[model samples]
Target: MNHKVCVQLVVAAWITGVPAQIGVTYQIFCQNFCGSNKLNHIFCDSSTLLEIACGDTYQKEISLLVNTFFFVVIPFLLILISYFRIIATILKLPSTSGKSKAFFTCSSHLMVVCLFYGSVTIVYVRSKSSHSAKSNKVFALLYTIVSPVLNPMIYIA
Candidate 1:
């Protein structure tokens, strides 16, 4: 298939999975959180919600880790594999300019992926504590703001 067709198929698959992801996330996180309504983090993301949870969180943490492994870690691994293949292909090109050009085509994409996923893993995947809340916000900001802004700058450049 052509690149466009392949992209469309990926998009279709992603669209179908989004609801399932959202559903599982909502089931895991949407709960009667007992604490000060005032949250410590800038956003009311899972990390913040988890900080305020009242009961024993062993079960919830396990579920979140499993869900994260499936949704985040798996996809990140796939992306890394794809980049490895791309890098191999680029390395095989004989012309110096050809290799650089090929690498440049996807370099920005890889950077953006690393920026977002690396920050996300730090913010959500790690076991959180009150002390870590401050650091989580920094990573969350990178995930939400800095990573996305790079997309336009890098891709549109």
Candidate 2:
């Protein structure tokens, strides 16, 4: 695809996300939280907030799950497939140095992708019964600290 098309696709993706974010955020905040306002996690993430909401969160959970599938899981799958193709191409490189360079770059990028999507999946995609709020907080904490630190180091290297 051309650069223009890629940029347009990215913008279009952002356009799609804006409504999901706003709609979810609006619905969550509109509710009177049943109990303590403070969440265990640092980030006031929507999923955690929904947990404390007074009324039925069935719609919110479904919306979150759908959004997670479309935004996080699908994109992660695409990245993994693209990386597999890249590794295959890299293995066919004639020179050892070229192969090593390609491998290093691809591995770093994959690590970042896994870290990001893994963190998100843990927090939002998992059934509330499957994980404790405290564990979610820990993962979210690690995700916020780890991904950004690694991004500059890995991508720039």
Candidate 3:
């Protein structure tokens, strides 16, 4: 059952990532080649993908929609529904230890999810601006640097 849920999440990620990647690639190419050279080069620079992506209107919109719906909305709903079912099942368990264990596990997972989605949403779903470069860099750093360090601690605890 847990394996199935993991597989579903993987599938959902792939479903979202592939199309969005393609769209963003096309849009970035257009912007870099035909539009205004918002990015430094024609082919994508992996190190600066996020910066390049946020620079163009088409890439930004598509990325926002895709990340908001796929990474944020769908995962949130799935986690919510799964937790509801888990709580129901846990409530019916005969032992207090079982209930405590379940709640602890769920709570930890929820914390990680909240941290991840919160950072992702802030970075992708928020307003764009010329003066927001610093804030955007901060958010990007949070998502890339901080999240990785925190996620493991969160999940393990």
Give Cα-based local distance difference scores for all models: 0.79, 0.85, 0.65
lDDT of 1 by residue, 1-157 (tens): 8999999989987986787568656854666677587888878776567667777767767766776777779889999999999999899999999998778878988989998988887776776543376787788899899998888888676
- Give the per-residue lDDT of model 3 (tens digit) for 1-157: 5999999979987887798767666655655333343544233332235555334465456665665777577777788888889889989999999899889888877776666667666756665453265555665666667777877786676
Off by over 4 Å in 1: 1-16, 22-30, 129-131
In model 3, the Cα lDDT at residue 76 comes to: 74
Better-scoring candidate (TM-score), 2 or 3 = 2
Quick one: best TM-score, which candidate?
Answer: 2
Candidate 2 lDDT over residue span 45-92, tens digit each: 888788878878898789889988988898889989998898989999
Off by over 4 Å in 3: 2-16, 33-63, 129-131, 154-157
- Pick the winner on TM-score between candidates 1 and 2: 2
TM-score, every prediction:
0.82, 0.91, 0.65
In order of lDDT, best first, we have: 2, 1, 3
Cα-lDDT of candidate 1: 0.79
Measured on C-alpha atoms, candidate 3 has an lDDT of 0.65
